[model samples]
Target: MNYMDEHILSLKNKLNYDVASNNVNTSLSQTVISEQDHSVSEKNLALRLGDELIPLELRVILDGEIEVSVPKSFSLMPLEQAKFKYPSEHRPEVIYTSEDGTVNITFNRTESTLANEELPEFVEQMADVLRSVQPIRNWLGTQVIVNHSGLSIGLIRFIAAGVDKNLYNEILLFTHAGQVMMGTFNCMESDMEAWLPVAENTVHSLHAVSLPLQSSLEKGADSL
Candidate 1:
């Protein structure tokens, strides 16, 4: 079978297993899940990414400390969600991709806060990393301030072109609550203009909510 069909089958098997284990009588339908019926906790902050009624999937990590909302048009994979590597630890929180596979978005969080002044150096390091993997055609990086969900956020926008003629764009942001978010969008050089804005808006829609330590502990206990 093709990859898409295999992916859909895998998702169905997972959902069926979850339902059977949970003893929930809900019927399993299509692989794509609706936003309203997502399984994430209600305590998590809501993030709206444009008005598109695209099918979405939700992923929670770090004992509900981090949440990610991804469109079903893209494939989703859960990651370890840890900064430092330990045995059996996954690095990224989640990953998404567009239907064509040329576009990709990765969502990750670090425990430490990222300072605005340090972004340029970080981008430089990233640029070096990208060059090591692929030949670079051009690179640009800039910082911007964004207001979303009543929070003033420091954002870094990085754009580059690889010798393969693919365009890459990434948005890095840090929250006052000491959470770092990174979203990378990639597409063909010719399609960059049309897809860049959509990627940027998706990044902008990311929202962080802070819960008291006691509340977090209580929630974790309840889940167990």
Candidate 2:
């Protein structure tokens, strides 16, 4: 069943009415959730190019639907790099933002009432949103790159490759600008593409492990 309409509407409702008031208003709802009939897998991979230890979590949202909440540090990059304007002709939602430095990203089908014949387009739009965050997979190597461009979004990219179909086919990353920001992947795929803040620490971290020297050999080996 296609719950696109219902899903989108429900999401809007949740955002409009579900806020706690106490001097601090924190929106409450199920943000960052995957659709049914899908599996999500996350892993921590070391980068081969940097000295920093990066935590990359891979989540595959199958049957494809994902909702993500954003961190306060992320935001739209302004007119030159990021556009915060809502889609007049075609735009994504600006789910959440706070003056106290809080942001949430949300994505789903448009609530403009999908025509009976618009299912294909609707699904494609949803897929495009999901595809925007897919990971770049390097089969022959042990590294991938991500570029996340959302508003004040302190994004943490995930890298997951070589998994059974039952595990994942799509990934999701969260930022403050919702769909306004852009992300890029570094690997190649015939049927796949990548998304989000270029992973700078994974491969570089894996290469930093050093091996101890032998008593006789007096040599040390390092991980790369």
Candidate 3:
């Protein structure tokens, strides 16, 4: 249930694909999704954060199969800058960066094959890996896997050391097209208080396309 191999090359190619063709209308959550509003509870709470709302845009990604909302001011990271900013040998499938490049949201769908029901287990495994990867990292919090819009989402947050400063990172994992899909939000630790709420709102706004399972579900329903 690991996230499997990095398909960076193919992912980069996919980044060039015209996502605009698959665009859909959507809106981000107006208020922060309450911390207690997760799989453990059926009722989701929306708490108002006094921070000014950031404009958001809804767009499709991962070959136009996933629909989600991100800050409208963010732009796709240019290939050269992605290499420089990330500089890591491994990188996400695609990255959207703030105008100054300090804040970022990333998306990556790995080659790992999986079924919908197995998502929570895999996510737990992934969480274990995250802990192992940075043994001394400051742990923020992790969420119980949640069912949203027919998709299973696992969220984890931590503070990772950046080149010259600390960063607040939140990662959301799910499955699509039989693969594990990852979405992330990160910013300087100084901005965490303001952006973390927005990140939570963004999580609520995401709606993964479930077409791949439709045919099978329909067949089973017919048989029933």
Candidate 4:
């Protein structure tokens, strides 16, 4: 199955959501990426969240077809480790995770064709689907932001009931090259206050770049 399909199955089996996939955990690591770490050839991408002051890094990932600012401490999740952390045979296409596998930022490119103006209503429709599928979840509503490139990004937040603990789930939807990209930021429900802004800023920092078709989003390192 494709990444999105498997992700949706994992969502249903683990996080009590409807037709979407992603998860999060506890404790943010303290590994800093400083100015000295960046080369002159790259754009300096960074952000600080709350009193914790976690640093962000510029990463061209998914076979180097997309540019995103993620926490400096995040790493691509290993396949073996992903199985237990996500508790599913299916998971997101690219998963950048914490040391303990509790928190995550995931990306999955879907075949859906989306237009710029349709993002807000599309996000609402997703919310309605989740509501009908799991009304017991703590509903935290949704928001829409247009990136610097005028791409509309849809953000949905909620507290999801998990088998062991609750998770603060944020679902992001946007399009690039007229195709949908579903990304997610998740952390422990208890850590929502500290991680929420990190998630938001990370989404704001998202932008795409051109690349050869051979190094496209269609393929990438499954684990690291």
- Which candidate leads in lDDT? 4
Tell me model 2's lDDT, rounded to 2 decimals: 0.26
Q: Per model, state how many residue pairs clash.
A: 1, 30, 0, 5
Report how far off residue 170 is in candidate 1 (Å): 1.5
Tell me the deviation in Å of residue 158 in model 4.
0.9
What are the per-residue Cα lDDT tens digits for candidate 4 across 103-136?
7888877656666677677777666666667533
Write the candidate numbers in order of decreasing lDDT.
4, 3, 1, 2
Runs in model 1 lying further than 4 Å from the true structure: 1-63, 66-70, 78-91, 114-135, 151-163, 210-224
Candidate 3 C-alpha lDDT tens digits along 60-163: 78787887766666789898876665555456667887666766778877665667786666555555565655432588777745445556777877776555
Identify the superior model by lDDT, candidate 2 or candidate 4: 4
lDDT of 1 by residue, 112-184 (tens): 4445454444444443444444334555545554534433444433334344344545544444454444544
For candidate 4, which ten residues in a row score worst on lDDT? 11-20
- Cα lDDT listed for each candidate: 0.43, 0.26, 0.60, 0.65
* Ranking, TM-score, top scorer first: 4, 3, 1, 2
Quote the RMSD, in angstroms, for model 4: 8.0
The C-alpha TM-scores of every prediction are 0.50, 0.22, 0.67, 0.71
For model 2, residues 89-149, the per-residue Cα lDDT tens digits are 2323333222232222323232344333433443344333333433323212211222221
